[model samples]
Target: MADNRKRRPINRPKFHHTTFATTKLHEMVEFYEKVAGLEPVHYGDEAAWLTNDDANHRIALLALPGLKLPQDKGHTAGLHHTAFEYESFDQWIDNYLRLKADGIVPFLNLDHGMTMSMYYQDPEGNGVEIQVDTFGNWHASKEWMWYSAEFAKDPIGAHFDPDKIAEARERGLSFEEIHRRCREGEYKPEVIPEVYLPEFW
Candidate 1:
């Protein structure tokens, strides 16, 4: 007997928002507001909901009493990172410089073929990534991730020196030029070691 049942694909679900429980709720709110440019749409006594978009909240921070910052361990099971996408390279660079001016450093910068990303840690040590797509559209970026030979060689992405990138920008290098160099692997910035745990899945 042939049995057939319609099953939902594993990748069908869309990502919603991510919530974090932190004792430093106020500090967390400030970090997101200042660094990520998010606004607190809903501010309550125990929780704060923030959004950069029209959605009710893109990120939520709950007041947790006596919550100790989690230690970074290779085996720790928790939230890996939350990523925010930017509309343009200029916007991404502007935010990066703004954070840099505030003395907030990104722990990692990478050319991911499909996107350029800068990873930072919040005051509570939660990972956050700010990125802009390499391609003009989502469909093209998705296809690039799957079919790009560069990505096939290194799916985890290649490290780049954020300082060098900043220097290039300061020298009046165009975004298009920088982006092309990154894609073609000609922008040889000093590669830094990745700090995050490797993905097993």
Candidate 2:
């Protein structure tokens, strides 16, 4: 079994927040405020700062003079997607329902073994991920990041079975249990996994 005591420094200082440049800053601010429950703390004709908690600003909306409309082809060029974390499954569901109530259907909903997620595009087609971690249910037997890559490739229609995941949870499975089985190589490696396991020994 690989030693699990090793820790690595976080790259890029972790995610701070995401900023969106929009031609209509007020519209962007309104969308974020109503849909994501962000509180608009400061605003002007061309910019705004929205916060959800203690962070000075979690999402910034900047007005551009002539921002072009996003192409619908799904290629974001430099940015792949942005994800937000929720502490509870119930809160996650609440967010999901709020989006639905606003007649905004998610692009996709997925079970990534380590996380369950809903994918969506903002008013300007910026990809976003609203996700809840499974706490400790990540597959430990093999590289699961391949599965994550697969999910990213088809963010809206990757293979995810809710019943299968529910069964795993119902059985009281833990990451330690999964890791033990993975040490024995009991599970097939995902085509593209979502989580990375260290090779410490």
Best by TM-score: 1
Per residue, candidate 1 scores C-alpha lDDT tens digits across 97-180 of: 888898987877888878888888786777789998878589999988888897898876767777667777888987767777
- Per-candidate clashes, comma-separated: 0, 12
Q: Once superposed on the true structure, which residue ranges of model 1 sit more than 4 Å away at CA?
A: 1-5, 9-14, 66-69, 73-75, 170-172, 183-191, 197-201
Looking at candidate 1, what is the lDDT of residue 149? 90
Candidate 1, 143: how far from true, in Å? Answer: 0.8
Quote the positional error of residue 127 for candidate 1 in Å.
Answer: 0.9
lDDT (Cα atoms) of all candidates against the true structure: 0.79, 0.60
Error of 1 at 168 (Å): 2.6
Q: Can you list the residue pairs that collide in candidate 1?
A: none
